[model samples]
Target: MAWQLEGTYFENCNCNMICPCSTSGLTEPATRDRCNVMLAFHVDRGDVNGVDVSGLNVAVVADTPALMSDGGWRMGLLMDSAASQEQADALGAVFGGKLGGPMEGLGPLVGEMLGMESRAITYANDGREHSVQIDDAINVKVEDFVSPLDATGAGVKVSGVGFPADTLAAGHATASTVNIFGLSWDNTGKNSFSAPFAWSA
Candidate 1:
């Protein structure tokens, strides 16, 4: 069977405003810290082979011991509570490295999987204004970029990376001091990344 999924997602990284991993070199915090990020996907309309997966929400929390390219990751997953057992299974398979998708490449780097939780995703998209929250691990609010800003006083914004830039999004994040399986994280700083993505099953 063959299936395709198209949706919108946002990621909040521990790096500066514009994470460099998307294009430039990997992130290296002074403490040699890792990158902690949360990705939330909103499926406008999608299907997994014969399974109807429209309107379902998926959230992935990941921690890379070092640069993402180095792999050795730890992850947790959250799904909408409204999904049925089958739906949950499908989502788990897709994200847990059970099914082949964009996530599969990260499988070898994964350790200490924290299983899955039931949660809801909320978003408010009003023109260039965007806000999203995932139960708790994520909270973002940002303004749309009409053009470029000037000088250092413009605040620190990292560019030269690739992500969904059309969602007109932004936000800061706060998470618990999380250490599950092989991952650990702290809730400090904000995050902002949005882009369109596709997946298969």
Candidate 2:
């Protein structure tokens, strides 16, 4: 079975501005002793093994050790409530790294699977700003950094990292809070990033 996804992605974590994990390829220690993060994706167009998944949203929440590359992450997956059972199953297989896709690269890092749930998700992207709300479990909003030197207010970007995107718009979270799966955190004013992503296998 072949699958592909093209989407806008954003994340917020309990790390200071310009997260060391992102810059150091997940090898550096987090600003805090642990890294609690929420990553959301808005699928503009995609399909999973012949299942249409366009316009849907998915999110990943995780609690990891300070050094992410050291593995042992407790993670959960949230699927759009509107998805049919077939769609949800397909999404789980892809995002859970059960399929041989980009997400497979993250498989080794997860030591605990927090299980999956269906939740109402709201994903929004307005220029340099991105936000997501997952039922009552999570809420996060971020704004990208704009360099004064550049006349265009484009976000400052970093490239060639081990993240989902080839380049990510560096930024900080304006507001972030999470309380789910026994993992709770308020990472407001911490690190955030956004980028367009395309993954297939």
Candidate 3:
């Protein structure tokens, strides 16, 4: 079966100012010599197999030991509670790397699946900020970056990170919470960003 998901995604990690995991370039060690990241997505327009999966949300949270390049990543995925069994299965197949797509490109890096949950998920991008909540699993808020030289803040873009997209706006987390995968962190003021995305399998 063929599937495609066009959406927007946001992510935050406990890396220095920027997370090398997103770019697939992590020659140096991160702040903690590891990466703990939470990523969420909103499918404004999508379809899986023959099922319509629009207006749904999904997420993948991970804890990677050593540099992102070193792999050995453990992760958990959250699907939209409202999705049907068919749609849910499709999302899982895609995100789990069982199907081909951008995720499949990273298939070699993932080492474990801690768990999966389908619960109320929310992803919103207001004029000033972006926020995502997956039931009680996590809550994240990303704020845009501003320049000291310029008074009016501009969305910052960083190209060639680990994300599938060509570029992503740089952000800093205002609020971050996690309670799953035996991984826990409150990474406020950490590396954060958002960008549009498209994936197919």
TM-score of predicted structure 3: 0.92
- As a whole number from 0 to 100, the lDDT of residue 153 in candidate 1 is 32
**Candidate 3 per-residue lDDT over residues 1-201, each given as its tens digit:** 888899888888887566655655656666776788888888988888888989888899998886766778898899899899888988888888888887787778888888888889888987558898877878999887876776656656798764567788887899999987788988899988788899886
For this target, which candidate reaches the highest TM-score against the unseen true structure?
2
Residue 64 CA displacement from its true place in model 3, Å = 0.2
Ranking by TM-score: 2, 3, 1
TM-score of each: 0.73, 0.97, 0.92
lDDT of 2 by residue, 1-201 (tens): 899999899999988888888788887999999999899999999999999999999999999999999999999999999899999998999999988887798899999999899999999998699999998899999999998898987769988875688899999999898998888999999999899999899
Clashing pairs in 1: 72-109, 73-109, 140-171, 141-170, 141-171, 142-170, 164-194, 164-195
Off by over 4 Å in 3: 24-28
Worst 10 residues of 2 by lDDT: 154-163
Model 2 off-target regions past 4 Å? none
Give the winner by TM-score: 1 or 3. Answer: 3
